[model samples]
Target: MTIDLEILHALSEAFGPPGDESQVRDLLRGRLAPLTDEVWTDVVGNLFALKRAKGESRGRVLVTAHMDEAALMVMQVGGDGLLSVRAAGKTEARGLLGQVVHLGPSRTPGVIGVQPVHLTPHERRQDLPDLGDLTVDIGVDSKDEAAGVVKRGDYAVPAAAFGRLGPLVKGKALDNRAGLVVALALLEGDYPCDLYIAFTAQEGVGARGARVAAYAVEPDLALVVDGVGVDELPDEDEPPPDVRLGEGPVLVLSDTRTLLDRGLSLRLQALAEAHGIPYQVLATRGETSDARGVQAAGAGIPTALVGLPIRYPHLPVSLAHPDDLEAAFRLLQAALSQPG
Candidate 1:
């Protein structure tokens, strides 16, 4: 269940918005071709791989990890070379101000901008700028000049480069990219059930890719692996929560979209304890993952969520511990190496 940090870093930095996931999928396709019995992409760009069971046949097990990142799309360009943008997913507009964004497949660079504080109204000095008032600057003089390299409906994401920072890894798209790396590790595991690993698209938008992939696979059991942020609020604001950066993976019981199956989650917890793999129960809420759409598919499919605790999940410098990711990979490999 160990991961190659170099490959994981590349996956985190690769550009792929909700609908435009070709770049990320291409890299995954290359890596999976050697390890899987069959690897292919669906109409919606979800990457599915199969590792067939050898002897006795068990049910299909779908393990999902989203490929899309929280990003923005170009809405319109202004006469002043500034571009208006729209959210591609549940984008955190507040975190976007003054951040660098990469545009399109070429990775063209741009910066989200707002008026300087000196020009703002005195009463508004302490308030954050509105997303509606924001614009992207690509250094062109006018709208016509900007059209040479930019266009409407292009994808924009945080210009985050991957690297190790002390004991943590910082990069963009860690929310689900961490899950993608964990899923890749399973390709090297001993599969007791027929494993169908899905690197889903459009999860940042609405889990659109997961819904379509689930209908196609129709597995008896599924697991959605995603990254959850560690609460970093000051103690004065609230007492510290159990979630921590260096802690092992977070075992999620429920989220905003669906309440995960308790029996499956308990089984994972019991396995963690028996193997002495450090883990913590996720105490945070108000989040969702691809598991929601998959669990509600035709005839109903039971699913659970495994979380990799991260900090500043959607911002430019999202942070995660490598140990947490390794833990997640090991726990899942062990889970799938048994009968469903």
Candidate 2:
């Protein structure tokens, strides 16, 4: 499977900060319209593209990839003119220092202001600043001036351009946008089951959109497309972790919030091995994903999480390999082509 760089780049660069996901939604809507039998959005803003079964319906299958990215929300417009902001999702405070952020619908650019290291006390130099202690410099000097541009509750995202770095793709929001691209590719296929591809919203804050979506779709079985953390650094002395970039898409056995279906996990692993597609597995304990809502919806939906392992997840800019993304698409395509 060939990964579409154009679509992946567009999704990665789209401004979708949790509650405000219209930009990402609209982008997906246009692409999905021609590929599916029907396209629609639910109340919670989960965009659905249905590609009905070509012959006798085997069962209903739901595939989801979150549209929202970690962001900062403006909390106050201080009299001093710098806007106070807080994390809207799992944004890392340590990564926020000196990074540029685009605020609200206008996409007004701002830089997170950090105290100069030279001016800071020695002990405090290594301290990470809380979200409340940070300010965004949008080039204004008064509360009245700042109010004219941005207001409280407005969302902001880190500014980063999407591009390829040799085998790796780098950009903000690849945490799930890589998954979005995989889901998009899946939409082109005609499956044995009635396929519902959900471009879910507010996943970064929680698996909020998927909860409503799963109830609405009522899929018999499901597959969650997401991105997982890759914890490799060149300077680290320890042995490398099992999950790594360029390896392949990850088949998550279990995570903090949800225990994935065993049958589905085995099917994915077997399919990958049979087809000679490279793959990896993870049973990480700390992080969670949209699978939390999806697997638990409507009594129960047996769901599996297939993740694209990415470096620097939840940060302003993340990195992934094109081959890994393509492998993920192939694995999913293979799964849907076969009967449940």
Provide the RMSD of all predictions against the true structure, rounded to 1 decimal. 1.3, 1.2
Q: How many clashes does each candidate structure show, in the order listed?
A: 0, 0
Can you write out model 1's per-residue Cα lDDT over 1-340, one digit (the tens) per residue? 3867788788888898899988899888989987999998999999999998866658799999999998988989899999998888867778898999999766789999877889999998888766667789998989999898789999899988899899888888888888898999899876778999999999987788998899899998999898887877677868787788878989888888788888898898988888888888874478788988888888888898899998988777788899999998888887887746
Candidate 2, residues 51-100, lDDT tens digits: the string is 99999999898999999999999999999899998888788787888999
| Worst lDDT 10-window in candidate 1 | 125-134
Give me the candidate number with maximum lDDT.
Answer: 2
Q: Give the distance in Å from residue 115's predicted Cα in candidate 2 to where it truly belongs.
A: 1.1
The alpha-carbon lDDT assigned to residue 188 of candidate 1 equals 85
Clashing pairs in 1: none
If candidate 2 were superposed on the true structure by all CA atoms, what would the RMSD be?
Answer: 1.2
User: Lowest lDDT 10-mer window, candidate 2?
Assistant: 233-242
